[model samples]
Target: MAGLSQIWAHIYTTTLVFFSILFLELVILVRAAAGSIHGCKNRPITTTQYLKLVEEKNPACRYKTGLRMESLECAVCLSKYEEEDEIRKLKKCNHTFHKDCLDTWLQQDWATCPLCRSMVLPEEVVVNYWRHQNYQEFDGSDEELIFLLSALHGNYIRRFL
Candidate 1:
């Protein structure tokens, strides 16, 4: 009887250890699944929200250098800006346009400009045009473009200080 009792105690201890390991593995699997699904379930920012953000942040919208606000056309859509229009301004380039237009245009195209087949940076399309025109004769490659962009960013940061 004592031998039987000891056997039962050993069996119970082994079962408990097995179950604890199983429970820990299940917890890890559940956490991994939740992380992957979380990203898939979430939606990106809407176009309207993007436009409002740009309008609030950019000082360019407040005033046009010499061009009339009405004369400005979206480099992506070739459409002019209208009141309450949702638009995004390229960070590297100062081009503004309807968000929907640019989003659709970028989906199909890769490097070429939406308006012209000019080699310009995707985000800084407007500034890229000016940069290309000025630096065309300077023998600057893509690497040089990147270096110039970094220098410009540093200059912008320094001006604030």
Candidate 2:
């Protein structure tokens, strides 16, 4: 059991490194979940709000009588609009798409127009939402933190580290 003392030192170093890595990884995951990955600053919106936005931002309805509908193709699906097809116009860029298609696109955490890549929502709206959201850092305490913390306030950490 003469070599047992050295083993304890090795074990302590390994444990410290593991906990540090774990804490960093948890921080990364939390930020990613809040829609901060890849510099995506687009403000996320809810489905209910989208209903009002469509009408408020303005929408284009292609009323067909005898004219060719080829000019009214939805950029999203790359298909021609029919009489019953719902149309939504983005007020910013004046680009239009099928309502369902645009909704699907927005739900993917992107707030830009599919064709022009312009912001679908206004800057003020995003700013206001961001203020309310106040995406704070993940400060929640967990088992890893607890374990590392306990090791810090004396006893095992003081003796081993």
Best by TM-score: 2
TM-score of 1: 0.29
Query: What's model 2's TM-score?
Result: 0.44
| Ten contiguous residues with the weakest lDDT in model 1 | 129-138
lDDT of candidates 1 onward, in order: 0.49, 0.66
**Candidates' TM-scores?**
0.29, 0.44
Off by over 4 Å in 2: 1-45, 60-62, 65-70, 124-161
Residue-wise C-alpha lDDT for candidate 1, range 4-108, written one tens digit per residue: 987776676556545644655676678667667867323233344433443444323322345444336777667666666666555534455566675555434
- Candidate 1 residue pairs in clash (backbone atoms < 3 Å): 93-124
Error of 1 at 134 (Å): 37
